[model samples]
Target: MTAVVHPAALPADLRAATIRTRVTVPLRFPDGYSTSAEVMTFHGLADGREHLLLALGGWEQVLLDGAAAPLVRVHSECMTGDVFGSERCDCGPQLREAVEDITATGGFLLYLRQEGRGIGLYSKLDAYALQDQGLDTYDANLALGHGEDERDYAAAAQMLRAVGAARVRLLSNNPDKAAQLTALGIDIEEQVATGVHLSEANSRYLAAKRDRTGHTLQLSRAGVVRPAKAAAGKAPGHSGMLARVDALVPGLRARAEEAEQLRRLPAVTVQELQDAGVFRILAPAGVGGYGLGAQSYGEAVRVLARGCASTAWTAGHLTEHAWMLARWPREVQEEVFANGHMPLAAATSAPVGSARKVPGGYAISGHWSFASGVMHSQWALLAVQLDGVRLQALVPNADLQLLDAWHTDGLRGTGSNDLRADGLFVPGHRMMDWAQLTGPDNPGSLLHRDPLIHAPMTTLLNLVAPAVAVGSAEYALDLFRHQLLMHKERNGSFVRQADSVLAQARYARAAGAVSTAQLHWQAALSLLPSEGQADAGLPEAQRAPFRLSLALAAEAAQEAVRLAAGGSGGSMHRLSHPLQRIQRDVGVLLNHPTLGIDPILEQAGRGLLGLELTMRSF
Candidate 1:
C-alpha cells in the first residue's frame, strides 16, 4: 500500500467515512435573490462529529474537475450571536456576508458545530459571566480551564478534502484560521477579510480579538464599527417604530392627568402621535402609510399604552378603522383618503341602526355608542341593517351628531361618546355589506392584496380591544415596580416594598401572566392568511379557539393589572395616579361584549366537545 497512495482517500486512522449525502437545493434570500447550492453532509468523522459542506452554484463540479480555486469559509457556530441577533459579537453579520458573497461567486462554505470557540455552550456562558466581571475574552477562557481558542481545524480540512477543494481563497478575518488551513496542506490562493460588525456591546470583545489573535479589524476612534448601507427598497421591521414610540412614553406619561382632565387625549399628545405616524400604520402604502401587519400594530399599541392607556386605546381604534376601510371599493377609498391625507375613522361594528334602501344608496338612522376617538375622526364606520341585511356604512364625520355620553370611571380620556345619525344618505360605494366584508370575494379583497384585509373580520374586530388591555397591564406592572423601589413605608422604618418576598413573587407572577397572554395573542395572529396566498380561511373550530384565546388574553391582562394595583398599596387609588386610571380602563375593556371571558370560553368548550354552539354567528 506504501507504493501508491490515493489523494482522495483519508488516512487509515481517520477511515470511518460512514455516511456521505448530497442534495441540490435552491437557497433564497428575503431580498428576493436565489441560487442553486449543493448541500453535502458527512457523518462519522475522526472527532465523532458531522459537518455540512455547501457548494454554491456548481462550485462542487468545478472543485471536482480541479478547474478553479473556490471562495471558501470555515465558520464556527455561535448560537447567541447568529440565531438571536445578539450584538455581543460580529458572528451573525460575518455569517450573513459570507453567505451572500459565496452565493454570488461559485464557492464552498463549511459550517462547523464548534460553539463558543469549542468551550461548549454552558462553559461559554460561564466564560461570559467571568467576562462580565472585567476579565478579557482570553482570561475568561483561561479562568474556565480552557485555551484562548480551543477550536480545531482538522475536521474543516477533512471536509474540504472530502468535497475535493484542494485550493481555496479563504474568506476570514482570523489569521489563525488561514495558518491552520495552510498547515493542513490545503493551498490558500488568497485571503479575504470580512467586515467589522460593531456595537457598544461587542466593541471590547472585538478589540481583544484584534489585539490578541491578530484579527484584521479596524475600529474608529470611538471604538465603534460602521455598518454597510442597507439595500434599496428594503422595508424596515417594527423595531424602528417601536423605538420611536418608546421615546415618547415619558412625555405621554407626564400628560396622563391633563388628558383625563380634558375629557380626551391631550391636543399635544394627539399631534405628537399623528406626527409619529401612529394612526396611519394600517393605511394603504399607496397613500403613504406603512400598511403594517397585526403583530407590529399590536406592539405599537402596547408600547403606547405604557405611557397612557386611554391614548393608546384611541390610537388603536383609529388604526384598526383604517384597516377596515381598506376593504371598501376603490372609489370609496379614494374619497376617504382624498388629498393624500389619511383620514382618522371611528368604528362601531354592532348592527344597531336601521337603513332604508334608496336609489344608489341607503338612508341610515340610528344611535351608535362606544365610538372611540370620534372627536378626532373625519369619518365613521357605522354598522346598520338595510333591507333586513347587515351593512357597514362609511359616513362623513360632519353628518353625525355627537352626544356627550362618555362618562366613565376608567378610560375617561378615550372620549368614547355616542354618535347619532338621522336619515344620513350614505352612497352605495361607501356602504359594504357586512357579509361581503367577511366573505372571501369582497371588493377590498378584489382591489387590494394586503394580507391584513384578507383576515376574518370577526378575528380582527376581536383583536382591537385586547391590545389596550395588554399594554395597560404592562404599564401597571412597571408602575408597581417603580412604586416598590421608590416609595418607603410610612411606619418610619424605611422599609422598601421590593425587599418583601411577597412583592417579588407578585411581580414575577404578573409578568409571567402578561407574557403568556402576549404569546397566545401572537399565536392566534399567526393563523391569519398572508399576502398573495389563496384564502383557505380558518375552520370554525380554529376560530372558536382563537376567540377563546383573545378572551383569555384580556382576562390575563386584567389579572395582571389587578395584582400590580394591589401590590402598589393605597396610593394607587388616588385619582391622579395613572395606575388607578389603567385599572379602571382595563376593567371597562374586560366588560366589552366581545372580550367577555365566559361566553368565549363556553364557545371554545362547545367546539372542543363537538357540541352544538348556542350562538348562531360563531
Candidate 2:
C-alpha cells in the first residue's frame, strides 16, 4: 500500500559524495529517427539535477535538487527487431531515444516495461507466425483475447515513489496510459512524442496507432480498428488452454517422485504460462483478450517457471507468437486464426528447402526445423532465404507435412518437429522483407509491427530456455525439500543419505540458488523497459542489454541446476527421475548459442563495465 524508497545502498557519506545535481544518460531512439539533445536540458533540467545515466536513452535521476519530485517512464518493450534492428517495430530505438530526450532535456522515465503490450515475448512471436498469414494488430488481438495493448504503469509509479517523487510529467503518445498514470497519482508533467520514428518498415503501424487507438500520431483514430478483411470466427480469447495448463503445476509436484517420466506437457505441468488463455494470448479485446502488460507477462512466466520448465518454455513461446501474428492484415489473419482450427501451434525454422520468385507470390519449397507444437499447429511459419535476405512464409498444413524432428535430450514433448514443403506457393503479399521494418515510416509495417513485433527476438526466444530451466529447478528443489520433511516427519531416513548433514546444507543451498536466479530473472525482466533513449547517436547501448539478457538468464539457469542437483543427491540420476529431465534440460539450455559466446551477452557485460568506467560508479 505504501511506496518505499531504495536509494543507493551504501554509507550515507558515500551516497552524499556521489550525489549530483544533474544526470547524464545515453539517448535511445527508434531505428530510423534522430534528434539533438539540447532541448532536454532547457525544458527538463531547468532546476538542475544530480543525475546518473542508467542506460542508453533510458535512465532515472534526482531532479532540480533532492527536494524535487521523482519522475518515471515505462518505455515500450520489443526485442527482436528492436535491439537487433530487425525491423519488426520501433520499440528498441524508442526506448533509448526517449530516455536521452527526457533525462537530458528535463525529466525521468519510469520505464514501465510492457513488451508486446504484455503478451510476453513468445506469445508476441506466435503473433508473428500469424502475421505471415495476414492479420492486422486488432484482428490478431481479437483472435487471442489479448487487449489491443497489454501495458500498465503501476510499477513505474511505485518506482517513482521509491525515488521520492509524488507528482511528475509523463512522456508518452497514448493518452490512455497517461490518464492511467494520472489516476494512479503519478504527476503528469507533460506529454511528449514517443512514436516510432518514421521508417518504411513501421509506417503502417504508426498510422494504425494514430488512427485506431488515438495514439496522437500524425494519423487519425478513425477506422484503424476496423477488420482489414472479415473477422475470423475464432477471434482472440476464444481459446482457454493456457489457463487450464497453468493450474497443474502445484498438484503435479505434490506427487514428485511419481511425476517423473511424465511426457504429457498438458497433464503434468501447472503455471500461468500453460493455461487455457495461452492460445488467445495475442488476440485482442473485441475478439476476447486480457491484453495484459509486460509486468503481467513476465510475472506469468516467472510463476510458470516454478513448476515444469519444458511446459513453461513451450507455453511462453507459443503465447508470444500468437500476439505477434495478431498485427497482420485481416485477410491474411483470417486464413490462419479465424477458422475452426484457427488457433494452431505450428512454426518452421531452417528454411530446409528453397523458394523461386513467382508471380503474385513466391513458389516456396523447404523443410523447416524445430517446428514446436507441430502436432497442434494447423498453420506454420517456414523461413525462406530470397534475394540474400530471410523472409517468413506462412502456409497451411495442407501444403506441408510434419516431419519427426523435435527429438532432443530436453523438452522432448514440445513436439518441435520439422515441416517438409516439397512445393508451396506463398503469394507476393504473403511475404515481407525482414529488414523493411522501421516503426515510424511503416507502410504495411506498422499495421504488422505491433508491440511484440519490436521486442528483441533472440532475447525473447531464449527466455523459454531459462524459464524451463528455472522452473525445473524449482520443482526439483520443492520435491527435495518435501522429501526432507517427509523423512523428518516419519522419523525415517531417505536411502540412508537424506539424513546426512550434506543433505541439509544442499537443501538450503539449492533453495537459495533457485530463489536467487528467480530474483535475477525478475531483475532482467525489469531491464526490458530501459533498453533505449530518444536521443542515442547510435543503436549500440540499446543492443547490448538485450544481448546481455541471454547470459544473465543462462547464469541463473546454471545456478538453479547446480543447486537442485546438489540438494537431490545421487537418486537424481535415475532414468525416470524428474531431476534427470531437469538436468538434461538445463544442460541443453547451456548449449544455447545465445549463451555460448553470444555477442549480445558480451555486449551487455561490456556495456555494464563501460558505464561504470564512464561514471566511475553505477
lDDT (CA) per prediction: 0.75, 0.52
* Backbone clash tally (model 2): 150
Poorly placed runs, candidate 1 (over 4 Å): 1-236, 349-351, 487-493, 529-536, 610-618
Q: Positional deviation of 184 in candidate 2, in angstroms?
A: 75
Estimated TM-score for each candidate: 0.59, 0.52
Off by over 4 Å in 2: 1-246, 251-275, 339-342, 351-353, 437-459, 488-499, 530-543, 597-600, 609-618
The TM-score of candidate 2 is 0.52
Note each model's CA RMSD in angstroms.
19.1, 25.4
lDDT tens digits, residue span 1-618, model 2: 112223242224311112123344333354444433321211122113222223222223445364444334556556775567755566656665665565554555543335577676767766654442335555555566687776654455444544445566555777777766665566676666564454434544554566567777642111111112222333332123234334545433332222223332433232222233554544443234444333345445545555545555666666655654554556665655554322555655565457789778898777678776665555676678876777767776777866765657776656566777665888876675544422323232344423434443444555566566566767667666655554211233324335778877877777777777677666656655432212111244544554455356556667766766665545466554566666776787777654664555445677756542131111
- Model 1 backbone overlap count: 0
lDDT of 2 at 99: 57
Model 1: how far residue 546 lies from native, Å:
1.8
lDDT of 1 at 553: 79
| Predicted structure with the largest lDDT when compared to the true one | 1
lDDT of candidate 1 over 499-534, digit per residue (tens): 889989998988888887787777666765543344
